[model samples]
Target: MDDPPRVGSTDVAVLPSDGGTNQPTVTEAPTTPTVTDSPAPTGDRTDPEQVAREFMTTYPRDVRELSDPTFLASLEGVNTALLDQVTDRSLEQAGHDSDETYERYAYTVTGTYQGQVQAFYSMVVARPAEPGEGGGAAENDLPFQVHSFDWAPGMIGDEDRPGPAAGKPVPITTEEREELIGQVRTDVIDPILTFDPDESPEQRQERLDELTVEPSTVTPPMSRSGRYAMIKETLSQTYSTEHGGPITITYAGTWVDPYDPTHNGSWSLTAAMAREDDDGFVVRSVEETAPSEGSG
Candidate 1:
């Protein structure tokens, strides 16, 4: 008997040319090469939803960090100018809160702007005030960065409305206007005019927190030396306060300097107010208006 065919050989029967008996022949078959699939191409970094999600996940919670120039440079395709404007406004409003935790949730591509995808997102952030802190911990809808080439970030105004469209200025009733003005007086004007010579740092911060929606809006006017006794009155309503809009109140005032009476002079200020949840209005920003004509 012929030796058994080798392990990798194919067995075949061959007949001799003289046609006598059939002989078994072993033939080697070509080895088939192994095939493997290469890993799928890495996910497209330019994908719009992917970029937005990555941005939200890695976004800096600290306002100071967001202000860094590198923060915008790290983004792939963002409108730095538009983003900076919105971010600066938002930081001015809520930058001073302590112990902030941001959680990104639902997101959708709203539309395309300037050939770039615009993504609108919703996130729940926990801003927990420190122990003995006046504001306390609250969950509110705040402005967050949106990814787009030309569109600015969408701000969350109310819980019912999820996008930037929610906060458009709406007409306010006469009663509502009076109520808002009262809030500005109690929450903003009074705080600015009142000066405590012996106030502690903690006490001053608590007072500021009580005045504005966030403590960061107004700086505590206190120092070791004598503080200026500010006198503010003659409030003029330059712009109507609308619901879900900004309230601009211009005040004519004078600053009294105890050390140098000559330094005391007439001054004017404009306080910009924003609606804070359902709790009336609160001062969001304060800027010096051009002083009106007056004698020193």
Candidate 2:
């Protein structure tokens, strides 16, 4: 008998005929299927995450000319006209950009609007031109973009106008709530309340200069020193004394409805505090509304 066929080799056999010469027959072995890698999934242009990333990368460059139709077109699903309007208003409020060059960005999806994902986009950019050493990105959440609003003021009650979809409630732990309250009191309220009556106008103005960020629309409490003592006394009697007597802090994770012009972005923290005043129970608040540090 022929030697056992080698592995994967065709088998040969001899066929005997009654009166004819023997012929060779060949049998083929089974072939193995070829393997190939499936093509990688293409980045979906409509995917909100993908779009948000692209936006973060491109916005710093595009913001220089926010009204450019070509630039606006790149922002898919955005209201171009409204974007232009807001850009004009923003420029009026914040003034033109200087020499800051944004190189890196981080973003978090906070909510969705009009079926598009909304995010807070933060960037690492050259700090404002300063003497001695250069400044870095603010340690606190001062500068960030509310992607859902297209970095513009969102529509409040204009049902006729296109607006962002209503954001879902963001849940936070009690610890988080307490922490945020502390931050508001420390970063926002303390600076407002800690003023010296003896300080001259120039000294007070210097203090205001330190506290005020560009495009500050909210009237700083330092501007109203007359009420500082009263506000402090009222707060002390209302909230916990150990924590510097913060007001009753009502924290909203995202934006407040009706569109607060004072707030920087939708994701900015807003706290409403109740205090006893001559007008009975009234709301006293200082909206920091900046994103947290290193969040970018």
Candidate 3:
């Protein structure tokens, strides 16, 4: 008869040397090995601010460094298009050369290359962070990724138009705010918006004359104060972050229509007063527009 089939590692059959009987023999089974997986160093970190700051610091100045593995973690949350944007712009500003320092925004050249940047700037803005779900703090809620990345033509610092006002917005009290509103009415809205048209030229002259005297004689607009709010009232600065972009007290308000005083339409006015160190706030400009920019 054919010999008994052999089994794998589990058991072996031994032929009896005495020819008495075929018996099975068992040998020790081989030992199984243990295994463990190691994760990447920065793959598990949760601090978005730290990660972003680090990424900005370590990101390569040379375009070639984009493929470097050392920066993989820092660029974890950034998208390819944004990365490409920065790379392209930086290279353009740096004159297609290597970047040297982030010390003071001169990021186009290092001692390694001949580069100088006079009119280029790059900015990174991150969105505000919020807490994760389940109430308690968690990494998922933090603004762990860049929200906006842009390359402007010139450097933007506190010294610029809006930059100058960036010097700690000056806080004003409720009384001061009211006073500003009153000033806005007397100096701004009353002149262009409050005019009756039917009133005699002398009356208009009187109104204009009143403006010359201190404590402005013009009766402030009735609903102007309540209707209009300071554009930068809460910003804590004399200047508003509006298009004009200066240290100016600016406001917009509506007045009851003289023609349609009952309930038809109203006059909308936007006024601005500049802030000078010596003169303080002065109404220097005013413009009238349709009720709203759009007809609707």
What residue pairs clash in candidate 3, if any at all?
100-109, 100-110, 158-163, 169-236, 169-237, 170-236, 170-237
lDDT of 2 by residue, 1-296 (tens): 12222222322111111110011110011112222332232364322233334444444345422111212222332223322222211111111122232211212223334454433212111111232234444322223221111122233223376333212111121122224345554554455445566776676555544332221223332222243322222122112212223224433222211232232222232333332211111123335544322121
Candidate 3 residue-pair clash tally? 7
Instruction: Return the candidate ranking by lDDT, descending.
Output: 1, 3, 2
Clash tally for model 2: 4
Candidate 2 regions exceeding 4 Å error are 1-177, 215-228, 234-296
lDDT of each: 0.35, 0.28, 0.29
Candidate 3 lDDT tens digits, 1-296? 22222222212111111100011110011112122222223542243324334445444332222211211222222223222223222221111111121011111211111133232222121222334565433343433322212222222233345221122212221123324555555554446345353566577555554332122233323323233221211112122324323223334444342333442233343444433222124444444444422122
Cα lDDT for residue 138, candidate 3: 36
Clashing pairs in 2: 113-165, 114-165, 268-289, 269-289
- Measured on C-alpha atoms, candidate 2 has an lDDT of 0.28
When 1 and 3 are scored with lDDT, the better candidate is 1
- State which candidate, 2 or 3, has the greater TM-score: 3
TM-score of 2: 0.20
- The numbered model that scores best in TM-score is 1
What shift in Å separates residue 200 of candidate 1 from its native position after superposition?
2.3
Error of 1 at 91 (Å): 44
- The better-scoring model by TM-score among 1 and 2 is 1
